[model samples]
Target: MAGLISKVFKAKWLLLGIALVLLLVWILRPFLDVFVYGIFVYYITRPIKQWLSRYIKNEGILVSVSLLMLALPLIILIAYTLLVGMSQLMAVVNSYGLTAALPSGPLTNMTTSFSQLHSNLTSGNFTLESVTDITRQDWYKTISGYSGNLPLLQAIAFSTGSTIVDIAFKLFIIFLVGFYMLKEDAHMQRWFAGTFPKLMDEHNRLLPRYASAVDADLQKLFFGNLLSIVFFAIIAAVVFEGLSIFAPVPSLQIPSPILLGILCGVSALIPIVGMWLVAGPLFLYLLISSLIAGTLFTHFGYFLFMVLAIFVFVLTIPSFVIQPFMARGQVHSGLLMFAYVLGPLVFGISGLFLGAIVLVLVTHYFGIVVPEMAAEGQESHDFDL
Candidate 1:
């Protein structure tokens, strides 16, 4: 009877623990959204905080100033870069006699290529005459359709307003979370450790070790790789802009150096030839624009640029692949699985950074908590030795 009662009591506690976890998840769902975004901002800004703490004579003042200096430029640059891209797109559209000329540039060029492939698959091959006829028909239909839907201006206004509101809310949450995370990061780590001391055994210590390894991996991967990418992107954009100015192609659209720089920089964060993801579209844009302008024969400069782009990509192959893996190896002994998680299911681009951190924390806790718990139960038997 005593043994039977103990088994029943253990089962009850197990069920109760599960129930409490479910309840907590339910309660925290709303706040978790904000916290998730907060975590991204925190990770990105953590290095800045560290730099301030290390170099600046005044810690608090330096952190405050660093944040202001960091934030102001980021906000302005993102806004201005996006604005220029939009402006260029709109100008390209307007330049074509089509009233709303569909802008096809380095970015949209990829979409156009995919669409053309889709058309080829669906619509079959066409002779030159048929192609010309189809193009004319499509152009006519597009213009007429757009004219008929001119009242979409109101819809555009509504959509723009909603987008602005949403962006404002997201930015507000990010900064709010970032500030607190930076301010109380040390306290938070302490809090994380303190809650489980009684529950921890030898095995439980493994959890903290694993978590620390994961955190260290992420800090190096996200920050170091990000800086490297940004530096390379600036170099690429300067090279591309210079190429375009002198390239023999009658290129009407010059890629904004800053915009391309930022785009390439961001793309560099993604693993394995992501810079090519940016470059491929850029080259396609040049190709299409060259075709439309009827200067394909004279565009020797673009050929040279195309060659240069390929060379740069080849040169950076080591940096993009081998370097990050080497960096990761130093921090995480078993993180190959963690690196693969980002490419498939990005919550957003930031998911790469956030997902790695969460996985680390979970594994850390499991490794530490489980081993410690097992060791506790083993103590009686082992003590007999």
Candidate 2:
């Protein structure tokens, strides 16, 4: 009777423990991407951190420096993309003679009003009357009707601000997670091994060995990806520059084709959609520029040919031919491609990470671990895998 009561108590606690774990999982489901990305960031920076540890004594400072270095390229990419993108788009529009869309007379008049208003404000003549006078101008009235969607614009701004905040929060979480992992990963690994000793045995070796192998391959895969990106960017830049020689109009040629090429390479991180993010906008810019300039009839053939060359030489050929060789020894080209392709098709965005992970684990286990285990594998830190 006493033993039965003890068993009942243990069962109840175990059930409660499971319930709490499930609750925790449910709470964290929304942040799965942030956590996965954090893990990715951790691995990518781990080597650098290890190297830095030789000189940097403080854990916090080391992690910060590593992350900053990693972020430098991203920050530069975004800032340059925005600054140049705006100028390029506007240049195209101006070059194309979009005068039919907005008359030059009204714009010149509007600019004069703005200049006068600025001068009045600076000279301390700022008042409702002055503002009203500027708004009352004929040119201002020409656009006032189009600007009637003030409430809608306000809502959009609010939504955009909220999204930025959410994204900022997620990035903080990702870095925080990475920081802690860098600081305490060794401790955590030791604790994990001690907490589950029997897991060292053959039946349990299945998971750890498989995981270790996958981890190694993933590291190699990422390194290979870096190399691929570099090569792709170089190749893309050259191709785009070469194609520019055929442009009938300057606007039809890519502005800073090298930067666009680098961005195309970086866009691979976006997965599934990939280079389209860079190339799509570019194609659209060209099409709109030619259309508005009334050069479409004469130049449409060039536009079509340019896009085809980009897709064939810069995109399609690289994926199947170049990248496979880049990742040759690390991952099977066919398998890697399939993972990248079918992953999104099968499971949506998360599938991008998931598919690669699953591929590594399965390939490593069946190909290596299973064979060794079946032959009675020896124990080592290698076995600790």
Identify the candidate with maximal TM-score: 2
Mind sharing the TM-score for model 2? 0.54
Every model: Cα RMSD to truth: 11.9, 12.5
The stretch of ten residues in a row with the least summed lDDT in candidate 1 is 340-349
Per-residue lDDT of 193-299 in model 1, one digit per residue for the tens? Answer: 78767534335466566666667755665555534544555566566667666666556344655456555655655567656776777778877787778876576
Please give, for residues 126-189, the per-residue lDDT of candidate 2 as tens digits.
3465554565564466456445444444443353233557868977897888788878888987
Tell me each candidate's TM-score: 0.53, 0.54
lDDT of each: 0.55, 0.64
At residue 295, what lDDT does model 2 achieve? 81
